[model samples]
Target: MNVLPQSKHYNLTHYQQRYNWDCGLSCILMILSTTQREQFLNNFEAICKEEGFGSSTWTIDLCYLLQRYQVRHEYYTQTLGIDPNYTQHMYYSKIIDKDEKRVTRKFKDAKAHGLRVMQRTVDMDVIIKHLARNGPVILLTNASLLTCDICKRNALEKFGYAGHYVVLCGYDMDSKKLYYHNPEVQDGHICRCLSEAMDTARTAFGTDQDIIFIYEQQQSSDQ
Candidate 1:
């Protein structure tokens, strides 16, 4: 098992709770925040021990591999010892229905008129809507690309994909800039050219129509 720094390990746990999304950026932030590199290596060893997995090299790589494997492995269920079928049913009937439109005809009677639908909004739109509701939405997004930023080019080179997920905490329609919560940057906020954000939004989330409106909990809302 490899040791990982204290700060890095905590960052991974913290970001997972905060972002609640699947993008590797949370893990990337974990690596970036730990000041003690050796301590960071130790943390990976701890994770492997708890997960009952081993690695050729005990380092952050092992932590990454275990987490990824657990997501798909049947052992994930065996360890929990709970049938996930009910959860899957609830996921389809309730959670996903609330967030996304289910267009698959198999879900309905054959003679019913089917409707074209869109899925959930991209990360930016969700964050923006949160701000609208709360008047100061603070959210993290994994940004690995920028059209003009020099650092962005380097990130792309290393990551082999421009699939950066950026936070849009707020938007200024008049100024045409979107504010972001970027964990990778020392600065708290990064301003993106609106067009660039739009382009990224199109690539990251294909449609604006499926934007999930944040209705009041008491409000009767149906998809």
Candidate 2:
């Protein structure tokens, strides 16, 4: 395991997504906030629309959007392929119901943007390492994983086992706790034990493992 940092955190309360479907967007905003980009902070929805993010957004969509903005980023997943059953369910339930042609076009557009996407099982150690490097991650997990009672209730009522996204901003290795910016919760930030975080992360629809979106901004020569 890598040496964990004592403590790390990012203030991203102002970037909370207004719509339930905008969690991914909210996480993107949180990441951009770290760069202190005012344009993204001021025009979130317009930027979302420009990125072709609809009611239901996928990690891939986010990757493309970040690439368009010249944000160096990648998405990590436990599996290289998506589960057939989950894909069928998403299509049938209209969770990702969209024009096939349009979706294909958007995917191609993202690919052209040169976004880097990687698939691998991630753990607490990896998360902590990233935080130590000052890289915030977009974590995908079930709403039940959150410590807030209201977030769990909302997750149960509105999402119901569906995947959710949050920003992992800090960690306390001494306490074995992970901190995140959860858009669904009232306070927007939650902390949980490492074990609990891992358990709830497996609640996602696919391989029942962890998936994350990470991007580190490149520093300029002038600086």
Candidate 3:
């Protein structure tokens, strides 16, 4: 979280310095490392001191920090270090129908089973409770129409959602936010806002539906 110099002043050497530490090349090269991305402000100040610079800028270099964090996060997830608890939800064509407008009931069934596996780790009630105890749970959601709407219904009817697979790890109730991890960003963009994310997800899945699924949170552990 290094704050960028407000006066457009920068330490060209530190900025361009090649990292020679034990950190990964990406992290060393990147100004803000993902391991410390959450504490970006503090990290920025440290970087300034280490680089023999000062900060007097109106706005910090949040964009760069966010970008670098995204990259490190992706590298962490895709590699063997990905946490098993992290939740991920997505929807794809089930049967590859004539316009691919329909999902195969079989595939949908499998997805529901996957959701069950996720719940086995932590039921929706537990997830909500954890969120209440913790903070806003950052959730990564698959905003596709089939995923957001159809899958839930299918999950309820067929004993589980086969097309929609959800994984739960952390939650935040205050800001009504959920954290999720996805490996889809070209240069360091990851995670999506639930509000607008649903719309974008729907478009990716080829749908005109305005449906947004709400993952309810509870204050009590008792369901």
lDDT of 1 by residue, 1-223 (tens): 5322111001121233133233233333332324433343457457545533232211122223323332111000011111234235532234333322222221232123222122223455444444344322222222333442322432344432222333333455455555443444444334444535444533432111112121122322111
Number of the candidate with higher TM-score, 1 or 3: 1
TM-score of each: 0.32, 0.74, 0.22
Model 3 lDDT per residue over 20-98, tens place:
2111112223333334544644465575444321321100111122233442111001112121222232222322222
Q: Best by lDDT, which number? A: 2
Question: Quick one: RMSD of model 1?
Answer: 16.9
RMSD of 2: 4.7
Please list the C-alpha lDDT of all candidates, in the order they appear.
0.31, 0.59, 0.26
- lDDT by residue (1-223, candidate 2, tens digit) is 6554577665444356687687777777766645444777677668767766556676677676677567676666654434336656743246534534445565455446675555567766666777667466776666653453223432344444556677776666676666677765556546444635544555456433545545455421110
State the lDDT at 97 in candidate 3: 25
lDDT of 1: 0.31
Ranking by lDDT: 2, 1, 3
